[model samples]
Target: MGESGTGEARPPSQMIDERIRELGDWRGDVLSQIRALIRQADPAVIEEWKWRGVPVWSRGGIICTGETYKSIVKMTFARGAALQDPSGLFNASLDGNTRRAIDIHEGEAIHPEALKALIRAAVDLNMSRTRR
Candidate 1:
């Protein structure tokens, strides 16, 4: 378990405490914005630890995740390559073989509308996959 700056403790494996501790002011602001986008998109989507340091959102299968690196905050979708990205918000170069990402550079504002659309698309896609 890890202790937050305020001394509240949480499970070590969850790593929410560690992540909060590691995020300095600016990064925390970025993370909060991303988190708000996800929540607004799907109020029912649950948050969980996935792929070690990433924050994952899902209803059935994985939906999306947010990670903070040295230069940017990366929000990745699990089946992003399969999602229709009409807005071209996701960047292919930053994606893994099965996932795609939107990289928000430092000091840049997150596109909340675009993010909500992506999250809704991802949830619909996952629901379709489960039905088949």
Candidate 2:
């Protein structure tokens, strides 16, 4: 068997790049920044396309999803409720039982290092769950 032996498959990272380029808006830039930070946080992170088009990043399990809407770019953490957020970066979907999201508006300032820490925490949380 060869690399294409499986089927006609476009790489997940390329799909995500297309999605970002398709936006052609501030959301695209924000999502790109978030994506970069995720990679910086975990160089081994896996990018995935799921739920009909959403961009998801995973390590041991799903770490987060990048969902862009008209007004905001949302980064939703899968095990956010179980992780510690001392910097209070999570500003959306806070009431949820499991997921937590950070909504990035056009003018809002994003803390790159803080966000990276959060990403690492999500990865750690996912790893802990998988081990147990």
Candidate 3:
């Protein structure tokens, strides 16, 4: 499941594990939690390492990316602007024309069901475009 953007054949999952372990703090915890949720949401989701260190998930098409900052763990959906967010989980990158993101802080709590719905929606969106 590990696909390298730099032509490296290393498993992306291993790289992600190293990144998470490197964080070794709350941000790591948050990232790990969200990663688990994403995997749970789509069992077939592929884990990839992009831009050298970013954790990306894709299926049919790009679904989302996991990026961590000092104060937040950002999950940016590839087609977020096209998905419905009735739960209002998207609190960051709200002004983009075609993308959306959820910025989670150290103590922030994520709505698992809502996030699962979002992941499913992203997958559906990707699949829809691929079918065309």
Better of 1 and 3 by lDDT: 3
TM-scores of the models, in the order given: 0.80, 0.92, 0.92
Clashing pairs in 2: none
Q: Could you tell me the TM-score of candidate 3?
A: 0.92
RMSD of each: 3.8, 3.6, 3.2
User: How would you encode candidate 1's per-residue C-alpha lDDT over 74-121 as one tens digit per residue?
Assistant: 877888888888888987444466789888887877778988999999
Residue lDDT tens for model 3, 13-113: 88889889999999888888889999999999999889868999999988999999998999999889999999999988999998999999888888999
lDDT of candidate model 2 versus the reference: 0.91
Give model 1's TM-score versus the native structure. 0.80
Better of 1 and 3 by TM-score: 3
lDDT of 2 by residue, 34-123 (tens): 999999999999999888789999999999999999999999999899889999999988898999999999988889999999999999
Candidate 2, TM-score vs. the true structure? 0.92
- Give the Cα error of residue 2 in candidate 1, in Å: 6.6
Task: Note the residue pairs that clash in candidate 1.
Answer: none
List candidate 1 segments past 4 Å from native.
1-18, 94-97
Clash totals for all candidate models: 0, 0, 1
